[model samples]
Target: MNEDPGRDVEQEEEELFEHYRFKVDPGQELVRIDKYLIDRLPNTSRNKIQSAARNGSVVVNGKSVKSNYKVKPKDEVAIVLPYPVREIELIPQNIPLDIIYEDDQLIVINKPADMVVHPGYGNYTGTLVNALVYHFDNLPERKSDYYGRPGLVHRLDKHTTGIMVVAKTEDALTNLAKQFYDRTTERRYHALVWGDVEEDMRIEGNLGRSFQNRKVMTVFPEGDHGKHAVTHVKVLKRFGLVTLVECKLETGRTHQIRTHLKWKGHPLFHDLEYGGDRIVRGTTHDKYKQFIHNCFELIPGQALHAKSLGFQHPKTHEWMQFDSELPQGFQELLNKWERYVTE
Candidate 1:
């Protein structure tokens, strides 16, 4: 139940060499490592979970096991958690980042749908952190110790592409984070959801972790530990049961728009971890390796885009705004399948 503690709890950020230990609850038995840890490890993608499990970083019942290993109740789970780190030498390889705007205070990048912004349970490499590591000489390897995250002011869902601001400096990071935390940040997204939904509507609810699954969030009538989130939606396209909607946020919370839409009975397509798993089972051209492209046009991931971001420049002390168009794939899919709504 223990490993190296010298650097595990140290002030180091990018300790790609340090490992961690995870214990499994024997009460929750008979589940695959990747499947089980994917839910248990919040902020980590399933693909990375599989990779970690395969690499022997994940243990089951105190024994190294494959990602597909099944756990029995009372099995002590252990994980040699990888430290969040960039390769320490990777140059920012000109990966075609869509920069909307940049200033002394902060920078905005149009994050792709599949882009992971920071370090998490299974994601140890190839992320915005890696990119920033190469782009900026000193972007702060780890913003916090316990989480081992970056200075990302906010995050878009890995599958939900769009605009997000990155703070290159500590003061800017704190200011931007406070704006979001104080509910003063203005953000919006283009979301193509299943089912025709109302236009220009406000959704208010107390969001909390789902009792059914810790991996998902839900809207509840009664108060929970979750924060209050407010979202406004306006319809852009309609296809009988599904519709393209634009959402603006008054309060930024984890998966606020996505979780809220799903709670309202209109989950985004391709959101496997959420209620969107049903889309993969669709009849036509459905089913792909762990995903489905079901956008009225075309999307390899969910049809949510972080289109616009508005916030006061932390350093400049002036209001700044940025916007990003949909990625080519999302736009192309929208053009092609815009009418395929035979439903």
Candidate 2:
């Protein structure tokens, strides 16, 4: 597909929210939308549905409706709600933060490598959320206090280093969440991949968790499954066996950049989960193999960095952009490649 950096904002908005659509049966009796939805959506509460209705996320026949709106027979009903929060207790930990900018409404930070964004099954502490809760008091949560994630508008991979924005107030959280759902935020990543990508290109496909491997993501080109994703790539430099490229995300899906680049035959270097750990290109000579092995040791994981981010300020409505430098290991890896190519 031809590269179109701009994506359909409405489609992306639907993707961002947990969207549900239902058609009333011809013999169905009239019922309140909130009550109707709660019956159909398992583990959902009336309060959550009512909140969605107040936010203009509930609709009947393509028109926004209130929670009390009656669902009539033969009517098409749709609603978009924020994802449900996992009930996990948050424990604050005093982790040093690399603060880029901070205001009453929000904070921008440069996240380092090897830090998980939030607590999960295998990871329960030493996360960005833990650090955030310890450093910033009263950060707004998107859903309920049960939600361990506070002020997290977006996230990066555990091994990915980059810039991220966190909201500080409820108003700021709502506004910034809407901005992300509308696909107005700008995100750029720098990646070193294992191939000679000659020109700029766009990768379009559906991305979902692999059926065989739940921990990893895979691309579904047939469009039969998964969420739509798009990544625009521009070649920055080539070192014969590998190349450095900048990736701009049009649609953010889990592992979008890594999966898309892998589908294009250029997986990020040292990406163990996606088949980039071993040599995918270049000579198999013992000397060259040794050089590649040493290069892999330079970075903790994949050679990818979220170098830039841009969005409108939630409170001021003014556009703001932030950029971050590559980590020392990533830079040193590049230097080694440069020297190897010149020799």
Best of the candidates, lDDT: 2
- In candidate 2, what are the lDDT values of residues 170-218, reduced to their tens digit? 4565556656766789999999999899899989999987899866889
* Cα displacement (Å) at residue 63, model 1: 56
TM-score per prediction, in order, is: 0.64, 0.80
Name the lDDT value of residue 50 in candidate 2.
78
Q: Which parts of model 2 have CA positions greater than 4 angstroms off?
A: 1-16, 20-80, 138-149
User: Which candidate gets the maximum TM-score versus the true structure?
Assistant: 2
- Can you tell me which runs of candidate 1 are displaced by over 4 Å? 1-96, 138-150, 279-297, 341-343
lDDT of 1 by residue, 1-343 (tens): 2233322111111122223345656577577767877676545567555545654456665566877888676666655433333323433433456777765556688887676776444654566766765655444443331122335656666777888787654455545554665456677888777776865688899776678876667788566566677789898888655677889887766678888888788888656666664552334543432223344335556778888888877756788877778888777656644545542
Each candidate structure's count of clashing pairs: 15, 0
TM-score for candidate 1, residues paired by index? 0.64
- Displacement of residue 31 (Cα, Å) in model 2 is 12
**How well does candidate 2 score on lDDT at residue 328?**
96
Task: For model 1, state the Cα shift of residue 308 in Å.
Answer: 0.2
